[model samples]
Every structure is written in structure tokens, then in C-alpha cells.
Target chain A: MRPSDIAFRLYLVALFTFVFLPILTSMVFSLNSDRFPTVPLGEFTTHWYKTAFSRPEVWTAFGNSLIVAVCAAALSTALGFVTAYTDFRYGFRFKPAYLALALLPPTIPLVIMGLAMLAWLGRLGISGTLSGIVVAHTVMGAPFAMAICRLRLSQMDPALEAAAWNLGASQWRAMRAVVIPFCLPALISAYCLTAAVSFDEFIVAWFVSGLNKTVPVMILEILQGNVDPQINAIGTVVFLTSMALVIVAQLLILRKTNA
Target chain B: MTDTDPLVRFSGVRKTYGTFEAVKHLDLDIGRGEFVAIMGPSGCGKTTTLRMLAGLEEPTAGEITIDGKRMNEVSAHDRDTPLVWQSLALFPFLNVKENVEFGLKMRGVSKPDRHGRAMLWLERLGLKGFETRRIDQLSGGQRQRVALARSLVTEPRMLLLDEPLSALDAHLVIRMQGVLTRLQKELGITFVYVTHSQSEAFAMADRVVIMGHGEIAQIGKPQEIFRAPKNRFVAEFVGRNNILPGKTPGQEIVVAADRMQVSASDPGEGALPAEFLSEEFAGTGIICYFEGPEGVELKAQVTEDQLENLAPEPGQRFWLTWAPGAAHVMAGT
Candidate 1:
């Protein structure tokens, strides 16, 4: 191989190693029968996995995270699709402003967004509840869903929906028959992405999820209490879950539409 | 409605987007079972007129009636005017058969009935075996036929076609034109076709409507529009005609290109002097352009034998005279 090609391949290898090494280290530690993670070889065992899952609080946290992710993904995807359809189908005054406001939440710093949600949901009396965490995640995730859906909608022929209407489909029927079917891939991708986002989120859930701890929140709590091997086991599970969701989302969005 | 009652009519119809008028004072009557083509340049409001008739666009100030029923506020889906778009706009996600059955599905027709009708149209358009194929798998012409079948499956009383053949190859365009004309004749439905192509409009249309600046320049049989254009715009837009100014003020005359004779020598009385500029090869004749008096351009279509006899060169002086009784005086300035 040419020297430049070899160098580029090495760079890519280094980049992936840098990204995955920490997760790989945690996975290795999750199986090691040791109190602390170290370079010296330790006997591999499932002791930490058993220990972490045995706790009722840990199980509750995992359940809460799943619930938040599903609810947040559904709510955000609905919001995103409506926002995208509005942008696609209408040409009203201040359209740019409408889009900016719709997509503005993600541009804010996560800490600030967390703080704002804590305060807003507090006034609504839903803070510290699982519903509050779901709402906060939905706000953060809607913009992503909106971006994906908007990209798909932009690629559509502007006349497709109108053609449906011309062929005896009313406005709602046209949406069901044409626009929704065309955006289905984007919708599913957005759902997976928002679900991953909500599942992995820690800061906003920490702010608003008062009593019901999500997985990330529980992991932090466990870390604050002590640096234990069980944290490594939980961390590996969290990482795998997020990665699975993200990979599915990526494949859905990148696939060539045979339509 | 009776065949002579006119299938569609527009009276004092005007459509304006803010300060820009897309269609101004359109008064047209499309007869039943007629093939009418609206020809114009881009942004000449031909599309807007079709959209209005299809209930996609509301007229600013007038009445549009389909079969004597006022249809100003009828929504698009409620109207039976199915339109074939310029882009075809077939649903990419749906297979060929599903796309054709869309209108029937929307109308809540039974599944088997929709399938039978869709198949009938697909077969009629010569797309029988490819029913289950994805839209992307089909060729451009096949997709075009799919779009036609999709619109025609509804068996509406009228069809609105917006530049449907403009995307086809020249040879394919000729083939599709024959297909479209044959289908229109067999269906005996009113076909409102909008096109910017002079030949497409002239070749297939029983009546050609020339639109310019959102107004009807002239509406007549293609041959009549070719033989006698009503005004300067009509004459110029229709093309291949020499529009000349009469000696009297505010008078203009239109002479067909074939009727104009180009002679090397002065032909005595009523001979107009012209200088040959260039010639374009038209299959049957050579269309010669000349710089005439008052700086107006004149066109004359001459046969190969006539061209060889004169042996005309660019910038060669010639006398222009028309056949007796061929000059038509245009109405209005």
C-alpha cells in the first residue's frame, strides 16, 4: 500500500480505538472478579452483573428509563412530524421564525435547558415525576426528529400530496395516503434516535426526575456512593442499549429509499 | 349535460397573487369531448387556468362552471377533474398497481373492483405485466404511462394534463402524442392540455388556445389559428408567419410564411425589399429569414428546388411579395 493510504488507515484505526477503548475497558471490568479495575488479570465472572441486577432500586431505575424513552420518543416524534409538515405544506409569514423557534431548544446548552425544564415543570407541578423527565426529554429530542423529518420532506416532490388530492383524496386522506407513507422511514428513524437520546440522557432527568431515578441517574448515584465493579456492569448494559438504538436509527436514515 | 352545452366555462375569471395577476379576465368555453390545448410561454397563466378548472385555485372574481354547476368553492378532491402533472408525481413508495388504484381507494371502492379497474387501465396503456414493479424500476416512459393510467382509472368526465409529454424524448413524445390522441378519441372525454410546445398543441389539439400575459390571444381550430392569427401576439406566438405593418397607421397584416415569395429581382408593383439573413432546414422546406423594411424580420418557407434556383446568400437583396388574397389584416393594433 502507498504510505499515505497506510497513514490514513492508521488514523481511522486510532480514531475508532479512542472512541471504543473506554467502553471496551468497562465491559472487561464488568466480568472481572475484582473490587477495583486494574491492569493485572483477574478471574472472569458474572458476579457484578448478578449483584447490580439483584437490587430492586436498580431494576426500578431501568424500568423508569425504558418508560421515559418510549414515551419521550413517541411524543417528540409526533411533535416533530407536525412541525415538519407545517414547514413543508405552508408558506406563511415569519416561516423562518417559526422554524427557528421550533428547532431552538437543542441549540441551548444542555445544563441551561435542564435548569429551565426543572423550573418550568416545577411550576406545572410535574417535576420530580417520571412524566416530568419524559416531558424534558421530549423537548430536547423533538428538534432531532424534526430535522430528520424535514430532510425527508424536502426531498419529496411538492406535487405528490397535491396529486393525491387531485385523485379524490381529501386533505386528511392525502396526508394518510401520501405524506405519511413518504415520511415513514424518517418517522421510524426519528423514533429510534429520540429513544436513544432519552435513554442516555442524565442531566435533565437528574434535574426533574426527583424520586424516580433513570439508569444514568442511578449509575451516578452508585458512583457517588462508591467506585464499584457493579457500576461497570450497568454501564456496559447502558452503552449496548444506546448503541443498538443509534445503529438502527443510522441505518434507517442512510438507506437508499427504493420508493 | 348536452354535448353542445360546453363541458366547462369560465366567465370574467381573474386570479391574482398579491399584485401579480396570473390569469386576467379569462373567458373560455371548453366543449364536451373536445381536445383543447392551452399554449403559452412560461408564467403565461396557462397552468393557473387549468388549476382553477380543477378546483385547485380559486378565481379572484368570476364564475367557473362545470356542466352548468357553479364550482368556485368546490374542493379539489370533490371534483372529478383528474390532472396529470408535468413531473408525473407518481407515488414512489407504491407499486405500479397500487398507484393506479389510489383514486379508487380514496373513493372507497371495494378492493376487487379497484383492482379490476386499475388493471383495465394498465392493460389499456400497455403496462399489463409490470403491475407489481416498483416505480423506480420502471423506465421514464413506463412511469409516464403509469401516471396516465393512474389518472385515467378514475374515468373522470374530464382530464387536465399539464405538460405531460414535455419530459419525454423527441421520438417518445411523438409516440405518446399518438397514444394520447387515440385515448382521447376513444374515451370521448374533454381533455384540457397545457403545453408550451407549439407542435404538441398544434399536432393533437382540435382547438388551440393561445395565451399571453394571462389573457387569451386567440382560440380557434389549430388550422384556423395557423391560417389567421387575430393580433400581433397571436401571430408572433404561433410562429412561422411574417407579420408586416400596413402603410396606413395602426394597421398590421399577417402573411403565412409559405405564401411569401422571395424573388431576386424587383417584382414590380407592391414588391417589398428585403435582405436574406439565414435559413433553417425544416424537413419539407427551408425557412428563410430576411431583414425587411422598417427593420422587421420576415420569414419565408421555400422548397429545395426554389432555393437552388435563386441560389440566395446571406445579405443578398430580394423582393418580398405574397400570393394574391393571402394577407390577413389583424384585428386591433
Candidate 2:
């Protein structure tokens, strides 16, 4: 191989190793029998996995996270699609201001957002509930969904919708038949990305989730109390799930553009 | 016009966006089964006019009627006017048959009936065996045919084409022009085609409407517009001509380059002196360039016979003349 090619390959390997080493270490330590994660690993065991799965709290937290993620994904994607379509198709005063406001949630500090949501939801008497967590996650995830969907919508040719309308389809029908289908790939990717974001969100859930604890919040609590190997197991699982969702989203976007 | 009653009429139509007027107050009439082409430079409101007629845009201050029925409030879906877009706008996700069946499906036609009709159009457009192929899989010409099929399957009363052939190669554009003319003739439907190419408009339209600055400059038969333009703009835009200040009152005369005669006779009074610049052999004839008085550049197309007879050379001076009736005079100097 050429010297430059060998150097480029080495750079890629180093980058991947640097990025993935934390997750790989966590997964390896999850399988270790040692109470505390150490340099020289103890005997390998599946006991922590069994213990993590056996806990009812873990199962409940997992279910809560799934529900919140699914609901948040659906809500954010729908809101994003509508907002993006409107922004792309219409001209109005203060459009930039509206878009900037829609995007503010993702740019704000998570701790500040969490505190604000806690205070707001407390006044509404829904603080620390599943609905509160879902709402918080939806707000946190929507900016990302809207950004991706808006890019796709902007790239689309408006003539397609015009063509549909010319062919006897009403505006709504044309959007349903043409615009929605054309934006489907981006929408699906947006949904997956938002689901992953909601599943992994920690700070907002920590603040707004009252009695109903999400998996991330529960994981934070467990880590605070004790550095149990069980936490490592669940962390590895969560990391893998988020990674899978992100990879799927990227693949979908790539496939659509290439097609 | 065969039908005395107009099929489409625009009475005092005007459209504006913010402070920019896209279409000025206009009046026009289109008879049934007439092929009308709107031709202009870009941003001259040709496409905007077509869009308004298709109900894509509503005029700010006027009424449009089709078949004597007011269309001011009718939405695009309810209007039986289909448009063929310049980009073709074929749905990338749908197969050929589904694309063609889209209109029928929207109208709530049953599956079997829409499918049969779509198939017939596909066959007619020479896409019979390619019904199930995805739109992205087709060639440029095939995609254009699919777009036409999709629009025509609905059997619209009038068809609007917005520079549909602009994206094709020159050879393909000519071929498609023939196809479009034949299709319009066979269907006997009013076809309002918008294009920037004067040749395309002249070749296909029964009457050409030339637009300038969001307003009609002139509307006439192709031959009339070419041979006898109404003004300096139409004269310059429609055909190659030399426009010069006329000797008569309130008149600017346009003389075709090929009709100017070069002679060695004594120059008469008011005969403009000119210096020969260059001559280019343009396949069938020679184009002689001259710098005339007042720095006005003049072009003359000399036939092969004329070139042989005169044998004009570079740097030669000659008096250019033409018959009095050959100059087409406009109202303003």
C-alpha cells in the first residue's frame, strides 16, 4: 500500500477506537464479575444481565422509556412535518422569527430547559408524570426533526405539488398523495432520530419526571447511589439501542438520496 | 374562429405580489380548440399568465371565464385544465401506471377502470411495456411521455404546457414539437403553451402572443407577426431585421437584411455612408457587416448569386438601398 493510504487507514482506525472505546469498555466491564470495574478483569459472568432483567423496577423504567420515546417521536414528527411544509410553501411576516423559536429548544442548555419545564409543569400540576416526560421529550426532539424535514422539503421541487393539483387533486389531496410521499424518507429518518434522542434524554427527564421514572433517570439514580455492574449492563444495552436507531436513520437517508 | 363564443376569456386580469406586478391588467380571448402559444423572454409573465388560467393563481382584480362560466372562484381541482410542467414532475416513488392513474384515482375512479384507462394512455404514449417501471428508471424522453400521459389521462378540456420541451436536446425538442402538434390536433382541445423559444412558438401555435414586461406586445398569426410586426419590439423580437430612423413622420422602418441592395451608383441625398467591416458565409448565404453613419452597425444578408455578382470585398464602401414598400413602418420613431 502507498504510504499516504496507510496513514489514512491508521487515522480512521484511531478515530473509531477513540470514539467507541468508552462504550466498548462499559460493555466489557458489564461482563466482568468484579464488584468494581478494574484494569485486570475478573471471571466473565452473565449474572449482572440476569439481575438487571430480573428487577421489576428496571422493566417498568424500560416500559416508561419506550412509551415516552414512541409518543415523543410521533408528536415531534407530525409537528415538524406541518411546520416544515408551511415554512417551505408560504411567505409571511416574521417567518424567520417563528423558525428560530421552533429551533430554540434544541439549542438551549439542557439543565436550564429541565428547570424551566419543571417550574412550568409544576404550575400545571403534571410535574414528574409520564405525560410530562413525554411532552418534555417531544419539545426537546422537535427542533431536530424540523431541521431535517425542512432541509428535505426545501430541496423538493414545488412543481410536483402543482402537477398533482393540475391533475384534479385538491390541495390537501395533492399534499397527501405527492408531498407526503416525497418527504417520507426524511420523515422516517426524522422519526427514528427523534425516538433515539427521546430514549437517551437524561436531564429533562430528571427534572420533569415525578413519580414515573424513565430508564435514563433510573440509570442516573442508580449510578449516583452505587457504581453497580448492573448499571453497566443496562448502559451497554441503551447505548446499543441508540446506536442502532441512529445507524438505521442514516442508512434510510442515504438510501433515499442514492435512489 | 369556428366557435363564435370564446372558450376562455380574461377580462382586466391583474396579479401582484407585494409591490411587484407579476401580471398587469390584461384582456384576452381564446376560442375553443385553438392552439395559442405565449412567447417571451424570462420573467415576462408568460408562465404566470398560464398559471392563472390553470387556476394555480387568482387574478387580483378581474374575472376569468371558461365556456362562459366564471372561473374566478373555482379551484384548480374543479377546473378541467391540466398542465404539463417543464420539469416533467413525475413522482419518483410511483411506477409509470400509478403516475398515469393519479388523476383518475383522485377523482375516485375505481381501481380496474383507472388501471385500464392508464394502460391505454401508456400504450398510446409508446410506454406499454414499461407501465410498472419506476419514474426514476426511465430516460428523459420516456419521463416526458409519462408526464404527458399522466396529464392527458384525465381528458382535460384544455391543456397548459409550461416550456415542457425546454429541457430536452435540440433534436428531441423538434421531435416533441411534432408530437405535441399532432396530439393537439387529434384531441381538438385548446392548448395554451408557454415558451421562450420563438421558433417553438412559431412552429406550433396557430396564433402567437408575444409578451413584454408583464403585458402583451402583440398577438397575431405566425406569418403576420413575422412579415408585418406591429411595432419596433415585435419587429426586432420576431425576425432578424435592421431597424432604422425613418424619413416619414412618426415612423420607424424595419428592413430585412437580405433585401438591402448594394450599388456603386452615385450616392443620393440622405443616403447614409457606411464602411464595410466583415463578411461571414452562413452556409446558404453571406452576412455582410457594415459600420454606418452615427456609429450604427448594419447587417445585410447577401445571397450566393448576389455575392458572386457584386464580389464585394472587405473595406469596400457601398450605398445600400431597398424598395419603398419593403420597409415595415411602425407608429413611433
DockQ of 2: 0.69
Runs off by more than 4 Å, candidate 2:
A1-5, A256-259, B261-273, B278-288, B302-315
Single-chain TM-score of chain A, each candidate: 0.97, 0.96
Error of 1 at A155 (Å): 1.0
Compared with the true structure, what per-residue lDDT tens digits does model 1 show for residues A145-254? 99999999988998899999999999999999999999999999999999999999998889889999999999999999999999999999999998999999899899
Clash count per candidate: 1, 2
**Runs off by more than 4 Å, candidate 1:** A1-4
* TM-score of the B chain in each candidate versus the native B chain: 0.97, 0.90
Candidate 2 Cα deviation (angstroms), residue B180: 0.5
Q: Give the alpha-carbon lDDT of every model.
A: 0.94, 0.87
Model 2: per-residue Cα lDDT over B212-318, one tens digit each: 87888889999777767778878777756777788766677888777777665536864556777888886548888887778777777888887777677777777
Per-residue alpha-carbon lDDT of candidate 1 for residues B1-333, written as tens digits (9 for 90 to 100): 676899899999999999999998899999999999999999999999999998889999999999999999999999999999999999999999999999999999999999999999999999999999999999889999999999999899899999999889899999999999999999999999999999999999999999999999899999899988999888888889988887688898999999999899998999889999999998769999999988899999999999999898999999999976899888874
Superposed on all Cα atoms, the candidates' RMSDs to the truth, in angstroms, are 1.7, 2.4
